[model samples]
Target: MVSSRERIKAFDKKLLKSGEYSVILSRLPAYIFELLLIVIATSGDKLSEMDVFIVMYAWGLTFYIAPYLNIWENRKNVSIYEVLKSLPVNQWDIFKVRVEYIAKLLLSRFLIMLGLQIPGFMMTGKILKENMINSLAAIGWAALVLTIYALPGISNYRSNKQIKWKAKQGGIMWKKM
Candidate 1:
């Protein structure tokens, strides 16, 4: 039997090998483009400092929301989660590790968004340093709100068994079977 420590390490390795990360990497450029478009469309001639900051914070928060939603909605796509579920490892441990992984991913995106904001702040004549606190606070609020939305989906996934999918004339749908 594998020890808990060994299982944890293996789970981490599985996550690394899963190749699902490419999804995030591939979408990154589109994210940047979309942000730029939003700025252009909304600002017209001038962009407000607070508006740009809100956009930056929102883009940062999307990092967390996207991954967690992917995990909860399509758990099977993440092979590490499957292995962890099958293993003797505590479910809570699996949950914690997944949460940590999500947080790490979020931070990476947050930093990238912060970097992009530099040019934006410069263009708007807003000092990034001066507005740093407010931007951070907005990021924090985004994280909190997204987390609140995620909890129910995770809990529902856990409490229910045999999640089922059905196809209709209109679209694909899922429900607890």
Candidate 2:
């Protein structure tokens, strides 16, 4: 029997081949902008409250909007969930792989942002508390937004139903079965 890790790896490889990974490429600009925000938030000795607020707001907005854009662009194509459903893989394994992938991406960015603050702290002997707080808030906002967007579909999948999108009268309709 294939180990769970091996099964997830196989499913991930198939997902990659199915062009599901292209969503990352499509959101590259947003990712770069997010990185720049992290650098700006962490590089300074003293970040103004306004500066931190603006940066965090932009970061959160990017996190919220990028997923919508990706979904809109791919609305006509079969979704990764649909493709996975057609496979012989277990549903729980699919959920694990997806959640793990998202967690890794988010955690890596958060770690990089935290790491970037180290040099300034080392030189100044002071932590930029406001910037750090804002950064934490931004990441928390991102996780919340993603969770809100993901939970319904995940629950539906767990319940052995799928959401199908169909066009009717030039608009989209969601049919869950």
Candidate 3:
């Protein structure tokens, strides 16, 4: 049988070539066009480069995560019973594939931000600009891995703490990572 990892790589390669992906990628062009318009519209006036970075960050945040969030939201409409009836290998395979896609999207966004930051830094220089990009780069790789691994248990970790607190009339225990 073909492995789930292979399936996901194939799917991503397909998606990268698809028109929908083209549309998604075109968002950057639209963003750049809008920024040009902003500059043109304010041609007589002075503006902060900070303002441009702020707008770019806000817009890119939406575009960066929209596709993954859409996938998660669609899962809400799926029938749990129907899914449960699927074969174990298929289920495991598909689950892994979805995780891979989500992971890839996250990594892609991180790299895109890092890629964009260099140009912005060139434009803004270190003295006037806040150093978010440099700071983000310092931690981005490790944070990405932790964020993915943290997803499986982060909420429950909080919930478990609450549960322990509520039951502390008997006793309490703590485990360190």
Candidate 4:
């Protein structure tokens, strides 16, 4: 008998496909990478300081927004409120899954980049001096922003569930300041 971990692995192998990643990656800031590669090629053998700045800028632009994509995705294609109000599972599960997916996808992308960067950094250790602290700060700030954006949807879902439950018991839900 396969263990739960094996089952999860099978499920992931089925649901997470290369084509799906291609779509997700396309939605991300691929253009920035393309531009960086072009500049590197034109430089004729090595990247310069400006190349490092460009890479950092690209990451800065994309990193923060990565965590919040779930919220944006939901906003663009909001789950039906009417349907959610009737579901048996707690309303938060839907938001939780979305946020989880975003985190997973972002980490996947980050891992891929880190895999590539480790080799590149090894080759030119000088560029490694770029402020790691700033990148970390950006990540923290972006996560905070993503969480804030998600709050509204999660709150909406929770409020809807509470209201539906109260109505089922013939009680009115009230909002107090």
- For each candidate in turn, the TM-score is 0.50, 0.58, 0.36, 0.40
* Tens digit per residue, CA lDDT, model 4, 57-129: 4454443333222212311322233334464444455445545554664455444444444556666563533
The runs of at least 3 residues in candidate 2 whose Cα sits more than 4 Å from the true structure, single-residue gaps closed, are 17-24, 45-75, 121-126, 152-177
Better of 2 and 4 by lDDT: 2
Q: Kindly list the per-residue Cα lDDT of model 3 for residues 39-140, writing each as its tens digit.
A: 432332222334554444434443342332222111121222122334343544544554555466546544554455555556645431334443243234
* Least accurate 10 contiguous residues by lDDT in model 3: 72-81
- Which lDDT value does model 3 have at 105? 52
For model 2, how does the per-residue alpha-carbon lDDT over 1-177 read when each residue is reduced to its tens digit?
Answer: 888757767755654556556656756766676756666656654444555555554445444333321232334433445445666766566556555555666676667766777776776677667557756666666565555444536444433322243354346565443
The residue pairs that clash in candidate 2, if any, are none
Per-model lDDT = 0.50, 0.54, 0.42, 0.43
Best by lDDT: 2
TM value for model 2? 0.58
Model 2: lDDT equals: 0.54
By lDDT rank, best first, the candidates go 2, 1, 4, 3
Instruction: Please list all clashing residue pairs in model 1, or write none if there are none.
Output: none
Cα RMSD for candidate 4?
Answer: 10.6
